[model samples]
Target: MKTKISHADVLDITAPSGGTTSGLAVLIGSLFGIAVTTNVAGDTVAVHTSGVFDHVKEGAGSGQAWAVGDAVYWDNTAKRLTKTTTSNTKVGYATAAALTTDTVGRFRIVPFA
Candidate 1:
């Protein structure tokens, strides 16, 4: 079941695409039902399953420990589900920040267990 997001212990996530290093983004729920910004880059869900991926914010261990049901976002512009596993959680509604900078991209994450 989707748990109402009263609060989220947000942790900045990072991923490495072509090896340029962008900011690790996050989309925590706010006081309203509005999401930070969905598919700003494209239509991709950003992170979905799991895989050995990289991040723009976190360092070396970005996607190294990717477990099943984890959210994986390899490309921001595409907004696609890169990876996911059995541990996936059905969140109430996913969200993303309104890209302070175009370089910042969007907050894309999928829960990984």
Candidate 2:
């Protein structure tokens, strides 16, 4: 016997606000994913919801530095990833260290179910 697994997890959702672009972070309800294309408000766009992605760009918290193996959280309010635990949602762990000079940080997608 064999089992099949589904890999098609990306979904199309309407951008709540205008100016959504590729590589930008988006949130729908409690779901978080990266935008795959430019979308205006009310326009349908593709969002990568799952799977391991390389260099999945995200904004770093102001003056916050990240170290390898540190647990990361998504600050929805700021639209950035942060090491702070106050009112932030867990996204994943940092694969590499992030410096204060860096505007964006890379992280592995380990979405909470």
Model 1: per-residue Cα lDDT over 41-80, one tens digit each:
3232233222222233222323433333434343334322
> Per-residue lDDT for 77-110 in model 2, tens only?
7677777788878777788887866766777767
- Model 2 regions lying over 4 Å from their true place: 1-8, 51-63
Assess each prediction's global lDDT (C-alpha) against the native: 0.29, 0.72
lDDT of model 2 at residue 51?
Answer: 54
Clashes of 2: 0
Q: What is the lDDT of residue 74 in candidate 2?
A: 73
Residue pair clashes in candidate 2: none
Clashes of each: 21, 0
